[model samples]
Target: MMGVAAAVFALTVGAQAPAEGSDQKRRLIEQKIRLVDTLINSPAARGAAEGQEAGSRALIRQGTQAIDDARKALADSRYDDAARLADDALRAVSSASRRMSPGEGALPESAQRKNLQDLGDQVAMYRNSIEELSRDAQKGSAAKTLLGHVDGLAAESRQLADAGRVGEAGKRMAEAYKLAVEELSRLRAGQEVLLSLKFDTPADEYAYEKKRFASNEIMVDMMVAEGRAIGDKRHLVDGFVEEGRRLGVQADEHAAAGQHAEAVRLMEQASAQLIRALQSMGVPVF
Candidate 1:
């Protein structure tokens, strides 16, 4: 009789456990749905969807689909699936909001000024770093190009500020800062790649060197495009740019003389110097 009672109790507990889990899952799904709905209805989300270009359109579409799927899952009593879909919708809508331009949403005067001031400080810091670099080496074509972009953006930012379009001005300054930071990051990555260079054969070493160089070239072009997209420019001095050019030239010379190992070594030295320059400019490499 005791064994029979024990078996019945175990069965009852097992049934209650699944019921508890199902209830918990359902509650979670409901909470997620509410959160996603709130985000989708926010001013930022509306601005992104209605005021922005193609990118925001795509994100909105994605979020809409996720919301629809979540609703369907909820109706079918698929709690876990509903939760997952609702979470995805939330992320999609949030990302769309972030992609909206500052022009779409006006900031308060005080807020705008504060943002602009902070961004201006960052840009000034980067420009100062570039100036320091200019003292060491002749600014290369790349550096010149970046400087032109920075100057143009800085001018535009000032104009916007004068016109009382503080939000737009702050956005431009922020973009300029981001561009400078990204370039610093790219240079640091290239330096690390060069430092890690090693190969068993001369052919292998040469191939790797070419590959790394090509990669850096592509990264530079991409960085330039990114800056342009945001109406900004990287701030890098001539000296910093010249060091990379010199290293590449010396590596090519070594490679031409069939000194693959020496070529790799020179490339590494060049990258190291670039990294050092970036660090000196107060860019965090790690």
Candidate 2:
């Protein structure tokens, strides 16, 4: 009688365990769904999505799909599937957040000044490229107008910085960048742009590329900060950033050893990794 009772108890426990586990998983899925829904409907998230060309719906497609699928799975009593779908939804929301930053506060004074300089350089480069193009191009008038606006923005940025308004200066530079980039895109439409800028030496080319890479790195950093790509992306972003930093350090060592060629190669490699990192973060930098 004792042996039979023990056997019955064990059988009953085994039968109950699966149901309990499934219940736990179902609760988890419901919790995750609630959290993800709250985040997806938050003001910041909506604003961030609207900032993109495709609007809010475009940014949340993956996440919404996951939510829908998770609901179906839950209804069907597929607790594991529901949990997995909820995770996917959470990641999608995180990725969207990291894309545009929604409208975060500006960086500190020093960072703003530095960002202004970098952004100014980017805008100037685009302006110069537009100006250097032949006047007979189809977009001649558009390019000229853009250059005028860019020059004005550059001057305004300088004035603002001189008055210790670095934050405003950064905004001006960002605007100038948008204008210049749009003009460049228009000018480059339906034609390949000629590489007109010539470097005096390999070192000069290397320096240019290094500056470009630094600018890209800064922009990505700022975006990450504003968007808070924390939950699932922290480790991945750190890994790529670390790889880029390591490569940069090695490049510096080579440069100090008088290997300009090798330094340039390493610098390019670092830039590539940084771009790769941005892509991994769903930044659409490519």
Candidate 3:
């Protein structure tokens, strides 16, 4: 009886040793995960994204996803999975944090000067376009005034560029360029200006997108029936159809999830892809 009891005690102790060791491992992994979370939300993670804002934001998104997975693994006591995921999260968040550091990666003086010059030229071109648009037959007083404002902005941008203030010049030129583009878009707000479309709600916009999508689909079908889609053109048109179909499905999924704005955006893109197919089939899109 004593020997049997002793054996049972030894087995119980061995089981407890592994459990305790696992608990310690779990704590350490959790600590690392918490630190990653904190780093992702810190000031450093919010700052650095000037020219590479999109890239920085994408890294942060990836890190966040990894962190979520790490937590899920930890919940299931998958220590190895939890650790690996936490490491991935740590790497992505660290990269994003570095990217967020303000003024850490300044371009050389020559590069800055070149960028400013390019931006200045774009601003000047946009100003010229606005000037030409103002001469159009149906332009209103409001349109002329908008054009005048853009011209003034372009002038200011040029002045800053001449003064050798690269950063200020770039910013002013970028603003002028954006305003000029908006003015042009507004003046040309019609069938081709998709972004200029107005809708009472995202749902209405989504519906319009669906109609546009269907129109494009029918156009492609007609092109096929007329034997327009042949040779390399057939292959190109098919690629567009596949991409449009994929995007349309994603749009529907977003719609089902109540993300109507995203759904509308995706549907619009899907329609645009199909329109490209029509254009490739010898039909003018715009």
Candidate 4:
């Protein structure tokens, strides 16, 4: 009985040794996994942080410049200029924040959400301000000056878009609202020059261009005729006259299609050819 008990005790010790060894191996494996995970995340976090910092720095610079410009304008008693500059600076700051924020992979959940929300609000405010400015330019008797602001707004919007600040770019135009108000004011005040132009449509403009070319041909032909009559400078005169006639006939077609600008241009070209022909023959200008 004593011998059997000793054997059983020995067997139990052996079993315990293997179990403990297995546990240690498992712990080592788990620790290695954790270390690798940490190693992978460290670089990604750093990259995200660096990107964010760079973006922030850029935004700060833009904001500073804008503010400086505004202050200068204000000092000069240029209220409108100051306001526009301030608005532009604020917009730059908003755009930079979005670009600086770590992409989804890098930022902690909370940071990303906050940044995005702030960006949205900034865009909305910019749109509103721009719309007001646009109207003021159109109706406040300084429409031309307002046009410059409108252009600035457009440029800023484009810059934000190019800078990967997409949300700001999509913001509605504040200038449009301002333009409407200005238009209303103009209607009531009966302003001079009403900011209007009879710009021809694309089709009309294209037709006119064709007519101008034709007019050149006509003038070329007239030059050739004179050159033939004058003798010796026939080759040069012929070339001009032929080109002029062709252009003039083309101009006529354009004119018939109601392309007055084209017809006029072509007529002028024809005249040029006639002059060239006369000059080549040493003929006197009539």
Candidate 5:
């Protein structure tokens, strides 16, 4: 009776253990899936996803080149050096992925700057990881082959990371940031130029006035987009005020050109245009 009872207990315990193990695996898989989803949806991930399909051939070419390099390094018995290079190559691939990710596009300037800095840090981390592995690679032929495979993977990763959809997305984000900075600089420059100009003649004043008006229009559009992205109401209001000032300047320019009646018409028109644009944006432009 004792022996029979012990067997029954042991079997029951074994069955319950398997069930618990299965549950644990399911939970782990779910967590991993969530992590993957977050990475895929990231701006950098989006950029990376964009060109990957079309850039597969280029990535293959890069991988091939890297393999050739590794083969030469191995022949020369620079095993550790080859390993480091291979690791660096792998990091390039990772960088490419980051560059390609689409979600990076919507990032604000401060956020985007941090992203680039973080990528540089990640590269450093990969270098350290690779160096640690290189120690084992020096021990034997099997380790060399393993290292070689890792090298190939790194090469391929570097190749595909950028050439794929993400490269173009990275370019767009870079351009957007550049344009924003340029626009902001232009506004500052225009302000300085306006203040410094010696408008001794009407023609000189007219040119300066026209230039200022044009600059103001550009600033308005840029700031509108920038403000929306950064959620900055102050930038939006400042843009509106600049627009108003532009109209007033244009009216003065017309009067300087000996067209008082036209000046009056323009002044009224400018006010209406500014009001309409501001109102549409839900701004109180009074």
Candidate 6:
């Protein structure tokens, strides 16, 4: 009986060792995920909002989904899976952050005069594009608004350069360039282009849809806040805000049902409505 008990005890200890190791790994992964989350919510992330890149957007969506999956796995007592998923989340967000960063080659500090000149030329090109877009009666307001922002950024960049802050100046120019590119793309490809999602699989599509819905929900709140701050005294913007909320609800339903494409469409519609409302209230969407 004593020998049998010893063998059983050894088996239990061996199993407990692996379990403990897994738990330790899970904890470490959780810590890493938290660190990555900080990067995801950092200023660079905010800067990334100035424009969209398919790869960067995909990474963010993948990271968000991975984090959620990790938590669910943890709840289900799949500690090893949880750790792996959490690590994946960390990598995704880190990659996304890196992708969103402005190219080092474009930094003004690298070649101050050349970069500045290039930026100026690009700004000029965008100005022409904006002018052409503004000719369309339907897009006039949006074109004007975007042009205003671009002009403001261009002026700021020049001022920063004058102050010997070439790097900062280059950043401003970079932002302007991104904004211009997005606008041009929209004008050329229609509004839906702004909402386009390129994913490797249905799972990727679902993840992106889920993440975009959350983002649009936040945008709705921002639109409302800005509208109120500006005193939508006439409540002219209320209709658009309400429509955005309604669409967001529909988007949530679609996402829950795994109708990712529909969810993305609704989320995009909601975002557009909110952006229009904000623009009407003189708030810059960017």
Query: What are the TM-scores, per candidate, against the unseen true structure?
Result: 0.39, 0.49, 0.34, 0.22, 0.22, 0.32
- Which runs of model 6 end up more than 4 angstroms from their true locations? 1-23, 102-160, 163-286
lDDT for each residue of candidate 4 in 1-286, tens digit (9 for 90 to 100): 4543332233223323445564443333233223222322333334444555666556556666776776676567554455456545544443343233233334444443333334333333334433444466444445444445545655665576567664443331223223323333444354332322234674554444343333222223333433433433443454454335445555666677987777767766765665565555543322
lDDT of 5 by residue, 113-211 (tens): 443333323233333433343464433343344445444544443444456434333334333333322332332332321212355665545444443
In model 5, the Cα lDDT at residue 21 comes to: 62
lDDT (Cα atoms) of all candidates against the true structure: 0.56, 0.65, 0.63, 0.44, 0.40, 0.58
The model with the greatest TM-score is 2
* Pick by lDDT: 3 or 5, better one: 3
TM-score of 1: 0.39
Candidate 6 local Cα displacement, residue 253, angstroms: 37
Better of 4 and 5 by lDDT: 4
Q: Go through the candidates in order and give the clash count of each.
A: 1, 0, 1, 33, 20, 0
Candidate 3 per-residue lDDT over residues 51-130, each given as its tens digit = 45777778878888998998998899887777777767766765564343211333334644654555555455555655
lDDT of model 5 at residue 170?
32
Over 200-273, each residue of candidate 2 has an lDDT whose tens digit, in order, gives: 98778677767766666655656477564565465556446544644666676678788888998999888887
Candidate 1 lDDT by residue in tens digits, 1-286: 4543332233223323456677766665565556556556655556556653667768877888898898898899876567667656756664564455444352346645755665665566566554444443544445555656776787889999999888778667766765665654443353432223346897576655554443332223233444421211122312333344346566766888999888888776655545443443444532
TM-score of 4: 0.22
By lDDT, rank the candidates, best first. 2, 3, 6, 1, 4, 5
Model 6 lDDT, full chain set: 0.58
Q: What is the C-alpha RMSD of each candidate to the true structure, in Å?
A: 21.2, 16.8, 22.3, 38.1, 31.0, 17.3
Measure candidate 4: CA RMSD.
Answer: 38.1
Candidate 6 TM-score over all chains jointly: 0.32
